[model samples]
Target: MGTLGRSGIVRKPNETMRMLVTTIIGVVFGFFIGVSFPTISLTKFNFPSNLIPSLNFTYMDNAWSSVTGHRQVNSLSGVPKMWVETNPRGAERLPPGIVTPDTDLYLRRLWGKPSEDLIIRPKYLVTFTVGLNQKTNIDSAVRKLSENFQVLLFHYDGRTSEWDEFEWSKRAIHVSVRKQTKWWYAKRFLHPDIVAPYDYIFIWDEDLGVDNFDAEEYIKLVRKHGLEISQPGLEPNSGLTWQMTKKRDDTEVHKETEERPGWCSDPHVPPCAAFVEIMAPVFSRDAWRCVWHMIQNDLVHGWGLDFALRKCVDPAHEKIGVVDAQSIVHQTVPSLGNQVSRGITLV
Candidate 1:
């Protein structure tokens, strides 16, 4: 695993990956602690004399990153080499393999230009939690998004290869696990650093109908209105629980929609104002960084998150709303609950 930057540079493994390096650092540091006030300087760094004022922790952190960030471990000639972990430990452990939290979906060629040549960073990310039955819906939705958006599908039904029929499928990312919610997959795989390249992120359910939605146009409205957290207004339907998300056909967006009796004590509060259902919410890059941290591992998808999304942005009421000009039909498919009933449990 190499550390990748937007510049398309994939750091080669740390060349000085010898146990002697570890042993030397450990021994030198131990000697410093042994002494009452050990001061070493750059002039006498080889043996550690009483000249250095203090340790440069920044240098040490870089060293640690070099040692742990990549798979390369023992280099006899102090020359960095490319390596791949084909037989991985899988998810039995906390991180399976590698300490780095960032990753991408670019397929690598065995022998060609440097891996950096493969970086085609997209400006946005649109993720869907899907099952086999929702293929038609997801395919249609993905087609509506421009090439600037990266497509990531979380396969809860464990069916991924079937999506290869689409030409775009060759470029998208797919993560398949038997039965899990999109929130779970987001927390685990969509680390902020991994998706930092994108300007916006769409974490949506697979049952959305994008027939009238244009991802690029939706983004334009989100930016034009200075919205940090937003969603496409829901097409008129009986399944809606909040009028705040319903499409207002005459407007570009609706920040404050009238709620039913006693549903919202304050018109500016959640479930009435600053509200967009979790089913199809779009978050700015900075907003998602904060929202991702707020997600609890135990939270079942879409149960109570729609209200708290306002916390991620400044001026919540002004920045959170529904874009009516670009909207989608929520199919109200039973994905999480149906999968859980088969085997998984809430408790």
Candidate 2:
């Protein structure tokens, strides 16, 4: 019977066989040592914290550490992990701390005075689209509107110096941009967010005659009727096509008025009710925000915007109206159009 070897294989008991078995065991052990030596050697080298694979943090964790200037410690491992600290505070305090009356006077200089004094801001604002040639008409309108309204003139003629001729111009803000349309100036300059401090905004053309319009009375009617969007009534000879805009002697304020046949079936719709022509539109601050967004950036002429104004206000019929008590005449002068066309052709 043959004897079993250590590997449970039957082998002949020869010197050559024993020598071959010992050599095979040495070769196998040496191969494992060679493979493990490089890994052990790599652990001895100290790499940067960022290069270490196990120390990497998630994007959110990194962001939190950067903003708060605190390192994210591993809760489970209880190890101090390396992280970015953007606003590091190392034995230093932040300035402008707790602004109380007892604070040092030198430190208080960095902060402005407390809000104890009353600041009287303008209640209403009016923007007039004016040309240099219409200075006479603008002066007349400003004279009547300046007492109660904060006037802002958008001079399309590019002749800003001409405003200096009128003494009332001292109270107005004149912005002169040449050859641009009224709506163009309005979109670029009269943002609702900037003008939110005012209660009402009047966007009127320069040709309008405001002899009959009373700024104070108009605001009173607007508040009483709860009109978010409104305009003064146009005189009969104002060349206005909409019947709702025409001056009504019977009522002080009218939301819905008669229009030409087939103009609008629903009286609650625009051009009949819940509408005011763009020539002289007044908007509440909240309504103006919506309307300012609705004004297309490319549509500079603003011809079709009046029809869409009602969409910005809820229950448009009640909130939008024409105040007959504060009426004006739309001279319907084509001077702005004529000059703009000429300027474009010249360019």
Model 1 lDDT per residue over 42-145, tens place: 22235453665576743653454455443333257754333333333442233335545456544576786775756665788889988888788888888898
* Candidate 1 CA-lDDT value: 0.78
Clashes of 2: 0
Residue-wise lDDT of candidate 2 within 207-278, one digit each (tens)? 899888888888999999999999998988898468888888999999998777889989899888998898
Backbone clash tally (model 1): 2
TM-score of each: 0.69, 0.66
Q: lDDT values of the candidates? A: 0.78, 0.76
Q: Candidate 1 — which residues are off by over 4 angstroms?
A: 1-107, 114-120, 337-347
Question: Roughly what TM-score does model 2 have, to 2 decimal places?
Answer: 0.66
Candidate 2 lDDT for residue 49: 78
